[model samples]
Target: MKNLVLGVNDAIYRACIGVAGLAIVIMALIIPWGVFSRYALGQGLGWPEPIAILLMVLFTFVGAAASYRAGAHMAVNALSDRLPPQVQPFLTLFVRLAMAAISLFMLVWGYKLCVATWNQYLSTLTWLRVGLSYAPIPLGGFITLLFVLEQLLYGDQHKRRVVDYECTEDSKEAV
Candidate 1:
């Protein structure tokens, strides 16, 4: 059961990285095309700007989930680090609980927000539903929630090879 869960999470993490990276690459290309079209071609393409914005939203949320799993999310540890060693465990548990709460909020509210706007379509991109753009919110929340559960149950998986490639490379550099 443990291996199965870990394997699934590893795959999910990889998928998140791929999706976020692809979104960034596509957004980069789209923005440049928009600029070129507006200034050089003498006509601004409405689709590119809105499309890029949507891609950005996708990137931010999906990338955040991957970041959390890798233990790369921004955190201020000054206070926690200063606390006595014995209290650190309690603090860690509190932090995890807090994350779970935030994740739940995002999951519930984000889904509601998405449903509320489901009927509306983007002004520039009529084919895409406004609700679809908001999907990453709940998706990210759910993914983060899974990671939180993994942490609480199995402890930090940050040292897992799939998530710690940078550390592996750094060690190679030292050799």
Candidate 2:
């Protein structure tokens, strides 16, 4: 079960990163193209701005899922590191479960928002609905929740053992 969750999450992470990177590349290329065309040729690349904004939105949320899988999200690890050796495991578990809960909640709520926005067409492009732009919310949240759950179940077992001062000969100072 753990492997299954990790496999799917990692797959999604890789795909999302690739798509988001492509979106950025497209935006970068198109913006310059639009500017150069308008200024040099006197004809506007009218589609670029709208397309760039759409891609930018995709990049933000897709990249967020990649960050979550890579454990690149912002966190304060200081307290966890300071925890006593015997308590570290529990602390780690707690943190993972907390993250999973939050991700799950977001997944549920984001799906609702996506559904609500489904029928509304984008202002700039009537052919494309706003739901298409916002679909990443539920998708990213689901991927993140899966990854965190996988880590909690399988990752902790593989962690390197840490030695603390209390477990070493330095503890003799108290006696």
Candidate 3:
């Protein structure tokens, strides 16, 4: 049972990170195209700006979840490190619980916001529902919730230092 749960959790983590990576890649390609089209080609495309914004939303939200799991979020490492080892575990749990609550709030309210605006369309992309734009909020919350629960149950997988988003020993075996 433990192995199965770990396997599933790891799979989800990988998928989220993969999607985040793809979003970044897409943004990298389009932004340059937008700039080139405006200056070099002398015909600026309107679609790329909005597309880039949407892609950015995906990148930030999805990447956030993966970063959270990897303990890569901007944290006060200096302060946390100053604390006694015995007190750190409980302090970490307290922080995780607080984060979990925030995630739940986002999940519930963000979905409501999405549904409320479902019938509306983007000013730029009229064919695209505004609701779609709001999807990343709840999605990010959901992913964070999963990661928080997994950490609570199995303990943090971020046992070693991770440099530049690369997987550590704990994460590599799962992949």
The model with the greatest TM-score is: 1
lDDT of 2 by residue, 1-175 (tens): 5445555555676788899899999999999998999999999865788889988877877787677667676779899889899998888788888888888887898899888999998776778888777777777778777667667765832232222212435566555
Task: Tell me the lDDT of model 1 at 98.
Answer: 95
**Segments of candidate 3 deviating more than 4 angstroms:** 160-175
Where does candidate 2 stray beyond 4 Å?
1-5, 43-46, 156-175
Q: Write the per-residue lDDT of candidate 1 for residues 33-118, one digit (tens) a residue.
A: 99999999999899998988888988998899889889999999999999999999999999998998988888999999999999
Give one digit per residue, the lDDT tens place, for model 3 in 38-153.
Answer: 99999988888899999899888888988998889988868679999999898899999999999899899989999999999999888889999999999999999988998898
Candidate lDDT (C-alpha), each: 0.90, 0.75, 0.86
Model 3: C-alpha RMSD to truth? 5.4
Clashing pairs in 1: none
lDDT of 1 at 11: 89
- Give the range of the ten consecutive residues with the poorest summed lDDT in model 1: 161-170
Q: How far is candidate 1 from the true structure (C-alpha RMSD, Å)?
A: 5.3
